[model samples]
Target: MEYEAIIGLETHIQLNTSSKIFCSCKADSWFDGPNTNICPVCTGMPGVLPVLNKAVVEKGALLAAAMNADLQPVSYFDRKNYFYPDLPKGYQISQYDRPLAKGGWLEVPLDGYQRRVGIWKLHLEEDAGKTKNENGQRMIDFNRCGVPLVEMVTGPDLRSADEAAAYLIRLRQLLRWIGVSEADMEKGHLRCDANVSVRLKGSETFNTKTEIKNVNSIEAVRAAINKEIERQVREYERGGKIEAWTLEWDEDTQTLKKMRSKETEADYRYFREPDLLPVHLTEAWKSAILADLPELPLARKARFIGEYGLPEYDADLLTAERSLSDYFESAVKAYGGDPKRVSNWLLNDVMRMLNESGKIAGELSLTPAYLAEIIKLVDAGTVNTNTGKALLDKVNESGKSPAQLVESEGLAKVSDAGAIRAVVEQVIAESPAEVESYRAGKVGLMGWFVGQVMKKLQGKADAQKARELFEELLK
Candidate 1:
């Protein structure tokens, strides 16, 4: 029987708040050494209390609203009892029965269709510490303890490994676009645990699923999910029952190793936390939080296509980042020309500069206004196309106005008919054989003669006028 894969993701997004969720310790300790950013509250010392960070709540609510989840006016934190080496508190402070939000969906645009991945639940939580095994000894670092995280669980809506990867890519884009998290999978800003199951095609009954962990990248998630699906399919072929297992992805081997059996929700003795009160988001507070939401990635992409007539490919790329999309629109409006022209310059010229300088679109020295000025100069025949393209570099490097660079450097197009005709006459005189070949029906040589004139003029000659001169003088 043909099988279909069902995938759900439990993603832990590290918020970019200034402080940890329940303490004054630093939120991001990625640059710091282990245990350097820790304190008694995060380490769970005896008789210590955690003061909830207000910023965490606001950011979490903003994300929940972006996902279209239903927010709870009053959501309480619970103590998830688990004894792990990395969990110093012996119980993790998380939301259990009553989470902050529930039931939202992300529209992931795949190759040819869109997949709506539903959000099962979203809750605020404090992260556990890190553990590593080395030289037959286990080492623990508490620096990550108490770090603010929004645990978002997605419904089992993905049908294939590609869909799971696409959902993750879209989620990462949304997170950064909304300024919630860096969402860098390699740096652990966004982490995912995929629960994967497969069933016979046309069957609605869900089979036993396996949880795969330690996939640090989207490509790894895709590979691990595909591997697990194949394993379950093989089991079905053998007429054996599949067991729910927790597997770890070995990056070096690109394989999954059985870690243990999957744990049910009952395994963790979850209870309401005694230290903190329930989160009560008043109408005004919710409004204030939602007010911070900007036009999301997909929405802006659609607008780019509809409002500006950008092709879907161009729109998708331009909206990959919020700042870049803002830059594109700003440039378009400033140029006052066809939007596609600005799109091409941005995608090709501006993007190359950004990549080389390790800067984003907004950080460019060549501002949108300056880019528009250059394009206008090109449009009005003040500068040749090559000169206009070179002005991008000159303006960026010198941080001067494009018009100023054109004036100071004598870069304006040689559109004067007398000047171009003189150069074209000189080029034809210097190349008699080529000129004869051109008159004898080697019409392609016309471009070469124009090239020689442009070369002599230092690329300042009006190409169209030179082409006209070549046609007239050659005949």
Candidate 2:
């Protein structure tokens, strides 16, 4: 019997505010000494009261709005009772029964089609401390404790690993556009947990689902979903009753193993957090926050196609990352709205350099003006295409004008018809046999003579001029 996979993702994103959620301890937990960013309140010391960070509240609300969540006027935090060494308070301050936002939908691109994945809720919560082990003994770092986080729970609308990845990509883009979080998986600022189960075709009820926790990377998330689905299918294939289980993804083995039974809603024993009050959002405040939201990926993609006349595929690739899209637009404007050329350089050359250096477009030193100038030179025929490419590489290292780089590197194309004629004649004289083949209807060999002329001229000749001159001489 065919099986249908049911998947839901619970993504935990650390808010980018400077301080912890309920205390003034710096949320700049990265690159700091262990436990250095902690305060008494964050560590849950006796007699300390938790004060909510207003910035965290605002950012959380913005994220909820960006995800198209239905905002509730009044929301409160709850104490999630649980026991863990990392959770020093023996309970986590979270939301239940009443969360800030709910019933939102994020549009995901799957199988070349757009589908809306339902967001169950986006709730504010405090993060737990990190557990570290040296040799064998476990130690707790309270620095991450009480940090602000938004737990975005999605409905079981995702059907496959590909769809899950698409949803995650879109969600990350939304978070970045709203400026709520850095959403860097490598830094653990954003984490995802998935609930996956398999049901028989046309089955009305869901089988026992397993929760795979703390998948940090997108690739890992896809792998976890696929692995869990396979496990569930195997159990049913063997006529074994599906059972609820919690699992952890082992990065080394690339597998999921059972940890425990799935926790029920009542297991956490959620109650209103006594130290905090219900969050109130004013109409004016929402309006002000809404004004600052940047253009999201989908909107930007449409503008790229409508305003710049870029192809849909190129527009999507250009806007896939924020910095890349920004770089592309700036270059287009700088180069007088030449969309196709900008797209070509960005997708081919710029992306190549970024991938090789392991950096984003924003991290590069090259300016849009410099990139535009280089492209302009290529388009104008002042420098040959290869020379323009070489000049682009030197732009980052030397910070010189494109013209200066061309002159200094002797890369200006030999476009003077007289100068190119000499090289073309030399190539035609040396490659008589190849030229004869071209004259005898082997027209593709024209490219071989073009290459020889370019080589003899040290790649300084305009390739198009060389090709034209070769054809003229051969005729």
Candidate 3:
């Protein structure tokens, strides 16, 4: 019997705010020592009160808008009651009933088609601390306590593991593009928990689902969910019922271990948070926050395809990052030529350089203007294509303009027909045997002749002009 997996992901994103959600302690304690970034307000001490960080609300709203979620006019926080060692407050201050925003969908491009995943919940919450089970003992770190997070849950609209991973990929791109979160899975900035259930392909009613946790990377998410789905299918085939267990993924061994029974919403015992006031999102305030939202990744990618006439592959590569996309647009405008030419240079050469140097497109010393000028020089035959490529490295290293470096390094193209004719004649005179073979119909030797002329001219000669001269002189 064929079975389909019903998959949904709940992602917790750490907002890039300066301070913790409700306290002045540093929000990002990724590098800090245990409990160093904590204060009375975040530490859950006796008689302490919580204060909402205005920046958290603003950034959360910005993400909500980007996700196409409906921003609520009035939202309230709730006390999510749980008793765990890492949760010092004994209850997490989160939004349960009235979250910041609700009801939205993000369009995800799968292998061929796009699927719109509905957002079941999008709310602001405080993060719990970390508990590490080291060698023979457990160590607790509260540095992550009170860290601001926007937890979003997706509907079970995904039918396969690949679709789930694609959703996370696009979500991470959107998060970073909007400048809201770093969304780095390795850094724990963005984490995901996938809930998976497998049922007969034609059945619409839900099956007993188990939740998988501790998947730190997107690849891990894909592998773990796939593994779980297979396990559930086998169990049912043997006439065994699937259990509702919270499973932990063993990334090292590539297996899943039952952690505990899955907890229900009633287990949370959620109630309105008593210490803080409800968030009143006024029209003007909401408008001001949404104003900061930039063009999302998908929208910009579509625009690149429609407006610039770029192929889907080129558009996808260029729009992978916001700065890279913007760089392409600026270069296109400055060059006033084929956008595909600029796209080719960026995807092949510029992207390689950026990766090697650990920099983004915006951080390049070769700005969009410099890039446009270099391509223009190639177009006008001011520099050969090889010399033009060298200029990219030279200009990036010295932060000099393309024209200045071309002049200083004597790298201009030798387009003079007479000058190229001299080199072509010298090549024919030097390689007599090769020249005879070429005239005797070793036509492939034409490329070798061009290479010889280019070497003599120090890669400054136009290969096209060299080829023409070679054909003329050999005849």
Show model 3 residue runs off by greater than 4 Å: 263-266
Give the per-residue lDDT digits (tens) of candidate 2, residues 1-475.
8998999999899999999899999996798988899887988888899999999888988888888887788899999998898898888999987898877888887666888899887899999999988989898898899989999889999988878988888888878767789999878878899988889879889777888986889999999899888888888899897777889999989988778875664577788999999988778877887777778889899999999999999998998888899999889889995688899998999898898888888877777889999998888888878877877778877878888878777887888899889988887788878878889999999888888878887877888888888878888
Q: Name the lDDT value of residue 343 in candidate 1.
A: 92
State which candidate, 2 or 3, has the greater lDDT.
3
State, as a TM-score between 0 and 1, how close model 3 is to the true structure.
0.97
Candidate 3, residues 1-475, lDDT tens digits: the string is 8999999999999999999999899989877788789887887899999999999999999999888999999999999998999999999999988999999999999778999999999999999999999998999988899999999999999999999999999999999999989999999999999999999999998999999999999999999999999999999999999989999999999999999986664588899999999999999999899889988888888999999899999999998999999999999999999999999999988998899999999999999999999999999989989999988888899999999999998999998999999888998889999988988999999989999988999999889999998888888
Reference-based lDDT, residue 394, model 2 = 89
The stretch of ten residues in a row with the least summed lDDT in candidate 2 is 257-266
The Cα local distance difference test for each model comes to: 0.93, 0.86, 0.93
lDDT of 1: 0.93
**TM-score per candidate, chains pooled:** 0.96, 0.90, 0.97
Ten-residue stretch with the least lDDT total in model 3:
261-270
- Between candidates 2 and 3, the one scoring higher on TM-score is 3
Error of 3 at 24 (Å): 1.2
